[model samples]
Target: MCFRIVIFVLFSISASMAQEPQEYLDFILPLIKEAGKELLTADNYQVEHKKEVYDLVTIYDRRIEDILINKIKKKYPNHKFIGEEESEINGISNLTDTPTWIIDPIDGTSNFVRQIPFAAISVGLVINKEQTMGVVYNPFLNECFTAIKGEGAYLNGNKIKTNGQTDINKTCFTYELSLARNEKYGDMYMYRLKHLTRVIPGIRSYGSATISLCYVAAGRIDAYQCDGLYPWDAAAGVLIVREAGGYVCDSNGGEFNLMDPNYLATSTKKLSDEIMAIERIADEERIRDAKAKTEG
Candidate 1:
């Protein structure tokens, strides 16, 4: 009898430990979904900013943050949360490996403010500074993209794997237009845009980086390119894209670091290589032009 009781207790402990990560997701997803619903109904949300023009936050953003923090604190008292608003308010700090939660209460706040449904709630969990699990909920579209490291990625609870379309013309692409508004390269941005537009059959510019990456993970799009994004904006989506068996790298074709402010991601390894090759050619052209003018 004593041996049986000990075995049962051990089994119970193992079960509980295994459930922790899923428990985190289960706890957070509903809150995010609820927040999304609230956003749809909110008519009085106003822009609240940390910096007058460069950074943007909204009342709905704060409300969602409050909801997330309250739930996270209540459920996991020892866990640390790094939210966009809190980070902006308290000043940014280094991300530690202590079971940190990275959140963008509402990614694509400009879209949200303008009554566009391209916004989403992005939640990611990191253990020892490596992203382990992420969930991006777009309530307006009723799409939920989730990934657990090594377990694969899913959309709406259905398994989603990157599709195989190695050809460029058959591929679909999405680009982030946010940075182009203040594009540092001037018309070089237009050059890349023109180049990509000519190649891909479909080219889209969606305001949500997280959602855009999710689309890639789900095979809705084949690639994504974006610049000037913070960690919170890309962290969850990066994990999703990677877990979906896609390739994610910096614009220079380097390994992806979550903290890096630039990224280029694609649904297939071959597609990424091709896209990077095109980007390099365009960059070379610009360099050659600059050198020619200097010598002249």
Candidate 2:
């Protein structure tokens, strides 16, 4: 009787776990679409700077964040929320193991401010410290990227996958340097960019992390790398990439941590390794230079 009870309990737990991501995805999809509609129709937005001069925030960022947070909190009162705008307002810095919603209401605020039509709304759901679901919507382009853990990724209701390109020399890569918050890191980023540009055939920067990751998932780009990113910036996109059969990790080829400020993602593990090799060399040189300056 005890053994039978244990089997039933295990089955129940498995069933619940399997349904969690789907449930969250169902709830978030419509919300994301609605928010994207709001962004597409928005006008006369007031923009402001965050900690850095280049770090921008707009009124729509706050409005959309508030709308999402309020709706989510109403639905799941116990679930936690980590929003970019709210984090700045409330000083929330850490992510816990509880179910949490990590959101970047306007992922490409700079582009939005410039009317560049390249921005997106990024939403990531984490449960027990693992990314379970992600949704990214580009209203201007009419593209919606969605993923549920253990399931495949989708773009506008169609399955997506990485380009599966292995050759670094022939691949198109994106290196985003705008997210670097400090001057020292900016210099290091430029140094790495110079080396990568020499080896890789086509290099581009779209200035939007969310869209960059989606593009990688959709096989539009071979790889994307950047440092000094927040969890809200990567939480959604990383899951979508992983579900789309891509590889993601820290720049050092370590396991991906959403809280970490650095990220390297590629369509294939081979391509990731090749890019990391170059990044590793640049990182070593940067470390040596920093140590030399300190000792000098």
Candidate 3:
């Protein structure tokens, strides 16, 4: 009986210690720093159009991604990867229970190309299909935000927290509305933008979703709403916001998914609920507008 109890206890302890987010965070710090240094020194970076004329990828994107994936693979041969460039060719990797590393080498490729300092090399670690840790590094701006599942979020080695502003009338917000330039997504984003504009003082659009989320995590912004984001784009930033004591949820006020994280992240749940209400109103208005147009 004593032997059996001891064995069970050891097994439980091992299971609990199986996947450590801090361990993963430690491993990634040097890698992102290395990538950052290269980015800062890089000039004459080659660029190519992805899906749209404005959607661009630079040579640094691939090079930095390869470095992260290769280094991580060397350490954890069994780990999986879902990277921006790699997904463009092989498609997104399956999100299984196995440990996976999500990588976005240059989240703001356009910003990087345009010499904007908002670009970041973002990464997230998922264990058992749940985001357990994340890191977002903007080298040009010298900001690195990090977080683990239970541990608090941090920026530049200092602990961080959301501002926790609850008033709907006093919210500062950001989103990606450039997708509206494409006809297929225009109404979907424009309607929400119109409603949001009426309530908020002025809207800010950072071409980089990673930066937007990081800024929210650091309490630099009160709320951020984004849609049509890939896993890598939001995976790291979402975890950072959540760990910073912010609320991250689906745009429809549903449970947020790390795999498809088209989310509304806010400093507080009350703020999230308020923004969600505005979004609901925007949706209804959009439906009415579409119906009227068709009837006309």
Candidate that scores best on lDDT: 2
Candidate 2 per-residue lDDT over residues 191-248, each given as its tens digit? 6877888889998888899999999999999999887788998989999999999999
Off by over 4 Å in 3: 1-19
Error of 3 at 19 (Å): 7.1
Ordered list by lDDT, greatest first: 2, 3, 1
| Predicted model with the maximum TM-score | 3
Models, CA RMSD each = 3.0, 2.2, 2.0
| Candidate 1 CA-lDDT value | 0.83
Q: On a 0 to 100 scale, what is the lDDT of residue 145 in model 2?
A: 95
Give the range where candidate 2 is weakest over 10 consecutive residues by summed lDDT.
176-185
**Candidate ordering by TM-score (highest first):** 3, 2, 1
Q: Each model's C-alpha lDDT?
A: 0.83, 0.89, 0.88
Instruction: Write one digit per residue (lDDT tens) for candidate 1, span 69-122.
Output: 888899889998878888877865677878888889888888888888898999
| lDDT measured at residue 95 in model 2 versus the true structure, 0 to 100 | 72
Error of 3 at 85 (Å): 0.4
lDDT of 3 by residue, 167-191 (tens): 8778889877775344556777888
Candidate 2, residue 219: lDDT:
99
